[model samples]
Target chain A: MELNKEEKAMASGELGEAVKWAINHQIKVGNFFDAKNFVSVSNVHMMIDPESVGIDGVLFLENLVGMGAKVKIPMITDPRGVDLNYYTPLGQTEEMANIERRTIKACTSMGILMTNTCVNYQTIMAPIFGEHVAYGDTGVVIYSNSVCGARSNYEGGPSALAAGLTGRTPRYGLHLEEKRIPTKKFLVKFKPEELTDWGLLGALIGKISGSYWEVPIIEGINHNPKSDELKHFGASMASYGSIPLFHMIGTTPEAKNYSSKFLNRLDDHIITLDDIISLKSQFGKKGDKIDVVVFAAPQLSIFEMQKVAELCIDKSFKVPVIICTSPQVYSDASRMKLIDQIEKTGAKVLEGTCFYNQYAREIGLANGWKRLMSNSAKIVNILGGYGYEPSLSSMENCIASAVAGEIV
Target chain B: MKTLLKCHIGIGKKVQGEVLSANDNFSARYDLDRLKGIFSRPQHKLVGKSYVDKILVLNESKGGVASAWMLYEMCARKMAPKAILFNKANTILAQGASLANLTICDRFIDGDITSLLSSGQRVTVDPMNGLVSIL
Candidate 1:
């Protein structure tokens, strides 16, 4: 926490200005640590709200361009930009639209490629196995740290953009070799069988981890989930908690060899099945049958969308089932005619909107939509806050709830 | 009514003063220029209602700073909120307060003002008993 005079002076700027200074000077704080510097990177993963129009959008674009010293980084987009479509569902104003259009134009013009999707890793900008990169997308941050073995912190917007510009970020915090150590242990009694269930499990881990960064090494549990399942789990953890990196003993790049960097420490907390179930009641509520099923809180990948499409079969949806996908995936689905097929199944497939931003209950209540179901614990927890009768279930259960008008 | 403004965190000196409630949440990232035609929407009508004066806001430290800057700029253009009372001087809220033109107040305490408040649009700041009686 020691600060030199310039660092101290820079810290005094307004948050934005301070961030601007930090980006410009590459000031490093002891608390904010990183490992090694990796350079000449082209692609950058970014998370920004699309609704930041006019001044907000213009200033952000201008600053981002200026900070990079006019160098462009390949930009990966987040589908749920700014959580705006959820907040203002009636449709955005011209200004809001302009903001969105201009911001995209700026990034695109600066040579920042946009997949315009949160599933950036799958769709585009899959940073190599050992690349050092700067990214601000929250879920991507967790994924890179845990899955890809790439390095980054939940570095806020300005910092992420600056890193994209300079092709360098301070080697500290989760980027440091020492900071990646596992700080907790968990015993898995029940193997989560589905992607939705994995999210619930990750939410359980996040609850136990609280606000501290922890390494979770799991024991027991016979069932081995696929990579997509783990991606869902990691994404859920990133959204529900502030965790930047986590390791599964048998899985995960850094933990595959059981490296000392991710081994258990004294500050670690041991967790069990009771811990998992405890999170269910602690983070979510036990309630009546659901009337609507919503998905894509942090935006779903194309694979998740396909899973939803497949699971909806044989399930009679009595409730409005809302499945949100990244625009890229939506476009692909439209070209492949999967969109029409899903629409025929009576499910509304929306794009560029994450459920987190929208008022489901208000819209649902207006449309006779009541009760809700989802596989995502984060969604269940957050939607519950909005008075929706949210329940956690598998994708099948959620699809069933949508078709049957009751929680399965 | 006597109102004591305190800084829960960061660099600011506490001061006891009278009350004036200028209520609004403003965002600096929002482009005011683009909002010309969109006044029909709620987010567009933020012009006059933005209370980014010299007033001090007591809120979280981290992300709150960005939002606070918007409030600060808006208020500075009009009238500053005189001063600010913070919970922590950390970047959480301090950055925003710093961006907004206002005198920083440093002090922290907890209490309830239910027994002390008699009338006039009363806003009680939780356990801090930071009571602002609008007159």
Candidate 2:
């Protein structure tokens, strides 16, 4: 990897130990991917969730903070593992909360903003067209890359933290221009009427695309998808495929730029209603009692909060209903009494945390929540491995199921 | 008998360990029971098996970015695979391997690493040389 004079200085430990470590780390990853040079990123987002971070990652961050490491550019975080205020009831141990606190303190010392969101594209400043960023969270990367036309690989916590420190990442993967071209083409023949439908479609595309290297170009979607709908779609796609970027021929920016060449062949995979239904059928059936109803994967946007709240109005839940949202949207929803309305129906709204990252396995065992039902296709796919019998459905159906205590 | 499988040069120091090959995709956040150092995901082929110190040969890395940090945490606890060889690895796994300083090689010229090595095979993974020798 080619480095400028300043990067050389950082590499030589003249800049600082943290910067040196950061640059060296980038060099190794850059070289592995055969990156030509480092690209300066506009911002960075990291996921330092406690369950993932544990003791070592916390200590690692603290070591950097002790060495006086500070982010060169704006840096935010993805959803944390433990929502400190509401952990105990949710089965998160004090050990987990302490790790979260230490991690937050270390990150704060290094000038990272604890945005605690997976929906940062919706809540925080959405990255602009062609803006390179080092973002953690698969959902964030896929959304920013596909919807917002930003360029980012799916940086894990350590890599994004390194980018935060150096203000640059090894220019490889999605940062490279030629790699963004459509690898597989999909023609969407079925209508994605609900958010879950969008999620299911995205998941099917991702599964078929398979490897992280294959970027699927999608077509034949007649409707303009809302932000939350695309959120589920992109999140579920990334969740299923480990894919970083995708192109929706008409909707996304880069897809539009390369629309002529990209859409020439759209017969790689033809998606139909039967294909999506086949995938959905594997989840669960109606009348299967659910342990809980959740409205998150990519945390809810403010608009989604309103929709959830409206559904919760003058209603009651027979089973637990958990909704996760970003702090920004949570505050706004709180001010609008959307939180109150949702909570009135015995639903719990956790701010600054997504359900999957929140010690999900432990919480499930503690609450005996084996039959998990969620509107997000991403969550259902994830919880299956975490010892939960996850079922998928639409948001309206999820709410209905919570009221009836079954998959309605 | 020893046979060498050439792969793309990958991250971390060379390591030698018993092989645990599975055709399934991997995600520490998804398939692992870290506390017990076992594959806990029911759908995974290696479910119920301990992965600690073994060379985990999988089809590819899939799902979630948390594996990046979890790799380091698991290594810190000595509960991680000694190395991971995928037919194709994702950006997250590479980044995680760098942080954990764990050996991970992918894109074998020999093709289909899972078929090349089975569970309980002893192998030496030389990531810098992009070669894995089945011993």
fnat, candidate 1? 0.00
Q: Over the stretch B3-113, how does candidate 1's per-residue lDDT look in tens digits?
A: 542323332223333322222222233212212211111322233332232233432122111233233333434433444443322221232333332344323554322
Q: Tell me the tens digit of each residue's lDDT in model 2 across B1-135.
A: 339999999999989989998889999998999999999989899999999999999998999899999999999999999999999999999999999999999999887889999999999999999999988
Candidate 2: residue A104 lDDT (0-100): 92
TM-score of the second chain, cand. 2: 0.97
RMSD of 2: 1.3
CA lDDT of B56 in candidate 1? 35
What's the TM-score of every candidate structure? 0.67, 0.98
Off by over 4 Å in 2: A259-267
Tens digit of per-residue lDDT, candidate 1, span A1-408? 444454344356533462455443344321212223333344566544543222543564666556443434555655543333433443334555455667666766556665556566666656666677766655676777777888665544445455565555555566567777766766666767677667767776765564325556555446666756766777666545446678776677776656544454434455455666666554335335566677876567777777776776555566667787777778888887776767777777777756644433345555555466777765665444334555777777667656656654
Candidate 2 CAPRI category: high
